[model samples]
Target: MATADTSETVAHNPPCTRRGSKDLPPDLRIVLLGSSVSENSGVGNFILGRAAFDSEAPPDVVERVGGRLKDRHVTIINSPQLLQTNISDHQITQTVRECVYLSDPGPHVIVLLLKHDQCSTEYQECVEKVLLSFSERVLQHAIVITTQEPTGTNDILQKIIQKCANRHFSLQRSSSPDDLLQMFDNIVQMNDRHHLDCEGLQNFSMTQQPTEIFSEGVKLNLVVCGSDGTLKSAISEQILQQTDRRSDMELHGRQISLVELPALTRLSEEEMMCQTLRCVSRCHPGVHVFLLIIPDAPLTVEDKAEVEKIHRIFSLSINKHILILIMQNSEHQTAELNKQTQSVIESFGGRHLFFGTKTQVSTLMENIEQMLEENGEGFFSTETFWEAHMKKLEEMLKKFHSLQTDIQSQGNLPKGQ
Candidate 1:
């Protein structure tokens, strides 16, 4: 059996040959969809031949882990617990996006895990909802894996299996890793080696298209602000240079403009205010997204102060439009995040990504699009900027008055002498 390799290291390793001569793709991507985290993670671990995913990971967050299995590089995307009755549609949509994002092009197999004896209408409905969340044709690429022997009397389970063209497997009956690998291969072969079409996965239907956020005339204005000035400049330059820029300097077809903002701490108070106003003006009506580039290192006092200044200038609500871009050093990438870095991310609504040196432009754009979608296609408008400015003025005025009152009270107090 092939042992699991660390996901971080898996990408850099060479692909191995598979057991058969079926001419399978080098990568086998599988997505685990189930109600039980333990069952899902267990199956994931079983397939990868190691415990790569955390069974205790938040039920709302989808995770992906990759490893080399025999001759093929296998990637498993563990979806959030979507079968619960209380799961919201938004949560479902978010999970679908994350799954698609993690799976990249798409998963080759959708493995639905379930207990053999557990059958209920609600459970079936939830399963259907999840399956349809990807696409109606997703069933063609699906397989049902039951914990125990699937009995003939379980109508719900039978119907699900039938819907999936009877592609079923018993985890208990499958004794070796090869059995599971073969199952995945069968699905790949049945589908003619084509992965699930992800172009439509963004909208949950083959016919539906993603909203035209970057419609012909509208340009996406991005402001790259962060404590790490060098990283910010590098990211901004990379984005501008790599994208297809037109004669007018805007990106062709989908227009995108990137502006780099230096650390506030480096600027004098007057320069800081002027720079903020200048950025807002250059972005015009609004800034679509603020890619706050933080180096993949512990936050220094200057970094914290810069972040605080950003919050003060943009208001706490600015977090809705902020996306943390952690510039990771390829040689120093670690599994664990810095505590202060994590806290900074949490403060910004947990919107972050570890941007390695080799990260692509598409990945950054996708994150920006996801953040925009979450914010209801809204941006930090000029009105919002002024509102935050006024709020800051109000706070300063209150503080000034309080200080004046304290001074008066001290003068009125009995002589300290």
Candidate 2:
């Protein structure tokens, strides 16, 4: 429960002795991993490189990125913006060797920060090459973090887990300090309690496949409510597809059922209840992840409180089956924006994840797919439901046709009359 921010709660002094060489700073033992390209490089310039890390990175950043373990704190140990040797040139092996030779013994979290859109056929070779040459020992101490959103219907993280056959891991994806700290804290706790680090955590036996990704017989129904302009339809669609992929339900041989809720909007309380509760009641025995899409515009404290009140009321009615997904919008680029967004969600007892819509659609779909593949249950075949939806569509179209016919008939007679 005592996290990096809560270090004061657990101890009076810093937890670890500085472990790097005497040349390294006295209170730090940090290293940087990933494609460490400099500011002048490709997409790495904006994201993948040194600017993301700082020796004087705020305290929260340090705790989230480098977890505290016993009396020896493990920080990223390499310099920022330093590229690993090219693997195909065979220099990568030597570079990793040098890092391993220099790195201290015992447990460390190797943050694998991969570039975005690197899953294409062109970059697949490089991705595989890095994974291949990166020693198991290094991987065992690793916490793979994908900086780029995976392009397919599912996230690269979910793909990796599925490829490994539902193997569990402590992997994470986030740029927020609070989420990062929670991730680090979870890893450290898992390590201490289970005698395992990140790698060990990944390799541990996940007796049953995670319910989020797949359920044997259960159905999950989620309702995501965010501000207007969030990807409500897209989120719902991805959840549908991902669950199909991960569940035991037959995708190729049988049909899976799907019931989608109508888009929620600002409306009267009576209308809101009729829409939300109706959807939930219909999707009974299923888990509902309510996405609260928030815009980046400044919100007064009263506004924040109002949103929290709404969330609380919903949670009480629904029993906390809601996952609050914070849709990442353009206005939320500032550090202040990040802090406020986090505070608002945590205050409401709901979990949150960030999504960048400006990125490729494939990546967005992939994130949703990952969630469903990680969370869905029951069958995906929806023959009966689709039939019903189509019937409704047909009825609406018939009414429209009749109205057009009436209007044309009236127009033809009006001039003469």
Candidate 3:
């Protein structure tokens, strides 16, 4: 429930003082988390008002550099880039330990430096893992400093900022050191001028343990289909160990049966009908959720047609069980989606999730659970339901054909006869 300071002015004075204070410490310690060695070092230099960190140094270990910023003794703990795929557990542990040891008592604020191009799901997971490794309440004392201005459409970045209690600063927008320091001051005051103590650090060891992926006696039937075959297969692979069309597994204490259907738009009408029936039969009892995977790009004419085709085949009733999964990567960084995509999302009542890592499978499950609770615990689709749905479609098609025939007959007879 952290409220944001909506004022545009940069000259607002903080409620607390950090310099020469009687009760507060004289040193202002900060930790920097970034995607690369150069990024972390550069931010550290910017804060210390000098070239304090070696950007060219080996990126394996963490380093602490101290200097004086006006009347305040400032310390910067430059951590090696932890937001990468290949970073080992040992490296993460060693870096966290070094950061804690160097900062001594603890850091006043943790600054997360993100570039516009680095806001992918992988990076999101990495950031979450690193922060949780430090302390659960670490974000309470954290400040997200993006290198560029953040837009409202970047859901992942917005979520991180929200977790930090709306405490955010843009380095590109405000380049002045004083402005940055003022943000730090705001964090200190908000946290009651207290740093993350040993008790908080003790919470660090918990994230090191394996994540339990069970929910106890819950079973989920998921049907994944979309316009992109590659994305559909990839997401299906993440859920099921084998690459078969249908696979079953136990996750988050729920037995999950997943069925991946081919892109309907790519198939002939007969093939599409056959595949649709197969999809319904495989998940025989009923489908709990339908995941439609799409590439994270501006909606194209083909994309819109693909979505329309899905509705036509599954019938409009499929809308409630559908969740649009947008696969995001570094290549497609534009957050401003086109009108067509917006309209499509609105059609589904904005049921969507930005997908990136296997870690998010649990999140997807939770969302599916919530959707089930809201829409009732019944299955979304079954064999009999699909058969009746096809019958309705056939009846609608016959009516349309009869109306066309009647219109043509009337036009022929009334031609000035």
Candidate 4:
């Protein structure tokens, strides 16, 4: 329901008075990304100004909130370089390292600020690579926060989201401190839950034994792309749960990162490609499948063109794989509706795949397995890591298996039997 509904309200304003100070960790590392043109770029200047002029400004909000300041803990760094030229891989990597990596205190969260202009393809690709490198070290630790002041809905912002798989937030009409604080809290909570959930999946245990050899080279990296957070979150959570339940299955672990591609009120093909390339470069190399999460809604000519362009870009590489997942809402399924949706996606070179309305556990498992097979990875039959897990499970459940067999054979014999 949250659409870019207004056309005359996008205005860039100067920073307003902030409310209660942000209660950050005694000393926290904050990283902000933006261009020189953005109004909020003056954050550094504002901080410096407050430090120098406001001697009576109550003890720094961070200190008063029972936070600790370990040495080399509080650091704020911004990329000094621009993405205007030489978007080569080497240049992009080096710039990011210099700006983002060198900060003594690493960032807990990353905030991306954008206005309404389209980005060049070179810049987009460079940014994508930088993000990928960042993820290698801090996968679940990354959070993309998009901020937009009341101005016309930005096509560039929407493109960025589509490409980067980051989260989005808006600061439409007001610049109130309470709103800022609330947004900050949401970022912290979301990041905390995401990291914890990933850790859980990465550290799950099993109760079985195995004797066969499995493929060690195959890595199934699945990237699910969509605009709706509800559908995205639901699909990702279900995939994780299903993978955890199947001990015998060669589950190629899932890494669910959301890309909120910016969709401006106006359309610009050049800007869209640039942003998409940037985000794609950050993805895992083993990401054999790209799931385009499309909601069943009427598509505009511009929307259709955007899809066509993205498809062409993705298809450039024979190694890159892509799929279309058209998620129909809670409405009754009809033949005509299905036909219309399928045609729309197929026009863009994507196959229309459906995951049942409830997206049941069975459906999740089957869909993943099918994807793995199409991408040339064999069934859940061959994973050495999983074999080891099976071994462990077999050991733990060995006694129970014998007991159950005896009871079944003797028609419910007593435990002593």
- What TM-score would each prediction reach against the true structure? 0.50, 0.29, 0.44, 0.39
Question: Ten consecutive residues with minimal summed lDDT in candidate 1?
Answer: 6-15
Residues 1-417, model 3: lDDT tens digits? 001121122222334454434444578888887767776776777777777767775454456678877767888877756666556554454366557766878888888877666677877888888888788789878878765544556878777777887777665543467767877877777777898764454233211111133234444667777776557666765554322222234322335556566566656576577667656765646777889887777776667777887887877678778898877775555555566667787787788877765335657767776787777766766654567677897999999999999989888895577
Name the regions of candidate 1 deviating beyond 4 angstroms. Answer: 1-22, 149-152, 203-417
What is the lDDT for 65 in model 3? 78
For each candidate in turn, give its C-alpha RMSD to the true structure in angstroms: 19.1, 23.3, 22.3, 23.5
Clashing pairs in 1: 16-71, 17-71
> On residues 1-417, what C-alpha lDDT tens digit does candidate 4 reach at each position?
111221112222223332323433434444545544232333322322222112222110011011123222334444423332333333333334433423333455554544444345554565555556445535334433333443565555556655533444453433432343344344445454232122221222221111122144334444555444345545555555554565655343333322223331222455454444434443334344556666666655644654555544444331225566666656744334455556756564554566545656455435545655665653221132235446657876987898889768898666786
CA lDDT, every prediction? Answer: 0.72, 0.39, 0.67, 0.42
Candidate 3 Cα outliers beyond 4 Å, as residue runs: 1-24, 149-152, 173-175, 199-417
TM-score pick, better of 3 and 4: 3
* Count of residue pairs whose backbone atoms collide, per candidate: 2, 30, 6, 35
After superposing candidate 2 on the true structure, give the runs of residues whose Cα lies further than 4 Å from its correct spot.
1-214, 237-265, 296-309, 315-319, 329-339, 358-417
Question: Residues 1-417, candidate 1, lDDT per residue (tens digit)?
Answer: 112331111111123343464578898889888887777887788788877867665454466789987677999988747666666554465467567766878889998887766668888988889888887789989988776544567888888888887777666632566666776787787788899986675533111112256566566777778777557656765564455332433334455555556568766576577667666665656888888888888888888999988887778868889888888877987657878998989988888888876777778777888887777778787778888889879999999999999999889999873
- Poorest stretch of ten by lDDT in candidate 4: 58-67
How displaced is residue 168 in candidate 3, in Å? 1.5
Candidate 4: global Cα-lDDT? 0.42
Ten residues in sequence with the least summed lDDT for candidate 3? 1-10
lDDT of 2 at 310: 54
Per-residue accuracy of model 2 over 1-417 as CA lDDT, tens digit each: 111222111111123332223322222222344444331121112222223333332111111134343333444444222233332222333233323333433233344444444434444445445544444433333444443333554365444433322322222232323343334344333333221122332222111123334344444334455444225544544544454455453232222223333333333355454544444444444433445556555554644654654553353333233345555556554323456766776665545555544434334334444556544423212333344446667988999999999999998895767
| lDDT at residue 249 of model 4 (Cα atoms) | 51
